[model samples]
Target: MTEVDLHMHTTASDGMNRPSENVRMALEAGLSAIAITDHDTVAGYVEAAQAGQTLGITVVPGVEISTVAEGQDIHILGYYIDVNDERLLERLRQLRSTRENRNAMLLERLRELGLDITIEEVIEQAGKSASGDETIGRPHIASVLVSKGYVASVHEAFDRYLGKGGAAYVNPPRVSPFEAVDWIHEAGGAAVVAHPGLYQADELVERIVRHGADGIEAFHSDHTPEDESRYAEMAARLQVLVTAGSDFHGERNGHELHAPIGSRRIGAHVLEQLKARAK
Candidate 1:
């Protein structure tokens, strides 16, 4: 079992579990530490960190930022971030605004495609998934599609409508990798390119490293054995830190609760190095 899971989510973003529940799940899974890296927001970290203090589990303050490179979306994970940084908060507020605007457009597109879902329906579904505190995301809309029987599952909804190339999809404004790394550093955090394999942009890694990324997510739920080896070699050759995580999202988006939380083993020392970079 993994003693440390550096990446996870909570109701503050798209994950099903609330911050406290995610903390309890991490403890129940026997993790010594975990990071709540919610998408585009740090709203959950305070609650998770507080719960960790009470339960004796370490909670690392983090966020998963969505950035675009070469017309494709990639994620950057920031560990030990100063969640209260004004500049960071400003950027996040803009991102949330972009998402909200995109959601409205997506709803219009879905309506044109003859789906019976509405924004009110999506909000209701998102509330059902969380404590009505989540950043409204495409997954919430997809869940509404599923509940309304317009789609068989969230995956189907995405495959047919919500995914990047789907008819209902709309591109949102995104910062470049360079900007993302700079933002994380400005917020007093270590920036790591998340799930590099998923990007299929091998050439992009060296470019990100050039932008001063502090680490590589060598082990992730989506990484293949080959990806692990390649990223390990890249991290070694570049002399960058290596980190691992389950990318646990509770039961949201077809993710199982326990399979990932305790699956990938991330050494405590990796986090130590990340914290050092944060300082």
Candidate 2:
């Protein structure tokens, strides 16, 4: 009943809804606050914040940065960032460029596999969903595949060909975890390790904590009840705040949007600590 969802996505990075539409959805869902944590892009935050204000919902400026550690992709979430931060924007622009180049290579690989999809088609599908300067992502490509009947589902598309080590997987350049934490801190936000349970490693949690992660996404859509409990305990032991959200990417991910508002609420005290650090 706290009415806060700190993790979500929009057309800025693979989510189906535009920023305004996502804000409307949050309002309709009775959410008091929501964060547009788009992958590698904050392009949706300004519009989302404006729309949230119009709807009387609080919007948290956020970003999900992709990082690599020990050869696996890890994501870090930054909340309460200054959306207009020039250095942050520059870094995000570089990341977006990397994503575009990686997607192009993936598309080429898919074509080589005899799939008739093209970068233009993917961009066209994304344009239908995006507002302003939002960038497209692999989820957008998966949607195109689904619509074309080339794949039955987004998960299927990823598992069959786009996920790490999959046929079309193209590794994008990643910033070091330390650098990611440093930037998020510099941008006046709290950095959290996303979905620790999915990593299935306690050592990774330790490594991230050592690297300046202030919190852990203890409750997530992909975490089981036991997993959640385990992470909550781990966070407490490590003296880090525990946060939660649905990681909602919208309709393309069937049954995902149902992760209700405040489904796994974080403490206001934790948010306060984050705010203090950001200041």
Candidate 3:
């Protein structure tokens, strides 16, 4: 049985590990392949691929795009993406810039609620939790809150201020689900709905399929046995490919679902299927 983890992160986004380190970890864990599905950016693929080449482990060029569906956050994972696709790169650049503005707005809201943390503080916290190069996100801010004792845990920080309906919650700018799938296709990748278990809607799987999802993430670190069964059934019914991954973001205090690479046994055939779909 081959092992592959098709969902992972690096310092390019919120994960603590660098792309090279992620590859090294994969090799150490005896993974046959791993994907660098960093949030919204394929910037880490180059380093990961280089490391994979040296280590003889397959590195799948991938990205996880955050989108919105019926006001809920939806993540779409793209496998075998052309990392140099101009359209994808430009859109990711815009998203990163917008996220910076959103972080500022969130901080202002925190101030309104009497939390006097600065952006610098959040950056410092992220620096401690990141690989020296990363796009600052709410996790970094939540880490800052945790370090300051403003929240007992990252989950607490989110519940109190960052989560939806929290006092400091700021709506992020995101593309639509259809747009996300189309962009992944435009980049010559197979678009799969990521971690269907994370969404509250019971019909999200079918909805994503309707939006042209080529596959579904049937196995994820956050997914329970029941969730996996449900997603597996949905993928079968929808006649789409099934994928699995640990969604490794490296070890962090608040980052749940932190598993070593290849913790989920993704069949090698799944990789072959994704590659077949790749242009």
lDDT score for residue 246 of model 2 = 82
Q: Global lDDT for candidate 1?
A: 0.83
Error of 2 at 178 (Å): 2.0
- How far does residue 193 in candidate 3 sit from its true spot (Å)? 0.4
- Candidate 3: 10-residue stretch with minimal lDDT: 125-134
Give the lowest summed-lDDT range of ten residues in model 2: 253-262
What RMSD, rounded to one decimal, does every model reach? 2.4, 2.4, 2.4
**TM-score of every model versus the real structure:** 0.93, 0.91, 0.93
Question: How far off is residue 94 in model 3, in Å?
Answer: 1.6
What's model 3's lDDT at 129? 36
Q: Model 2, 1-279: lDDT tens per residue?
A: 445778888877877778898788777777777888998889888899889889988888999988777777788999998888899988987777777788888999999988889877887877753333467788888878888988888888888878887888887667867788888988988898888887777797778887788888888888999989998888898888888888877777363533544565554455666676563
- Order by TM-score, highest first: 1, 3, 2
- Model 1 weakest 10-residue run by lDDT: 125-134
- What tens digits encode model 1's per-residue C-alpha lDDT throughout 33-119? 998988889999999989999999899999998888787888899998999999998898777777778889999999999997777
Question: Model 1: how far is 104 from its true place, Å?
Answer: 1.6
The superposed Cα distance between candidate 3 and the true structure at residue 197, in angstroms, equals: 1.0
Per-residue accuracy of model 3 over 125-201 as CA lDDT, tens digit each: 67643222246788888888878778888788888899887889987667877798999998999999998888867
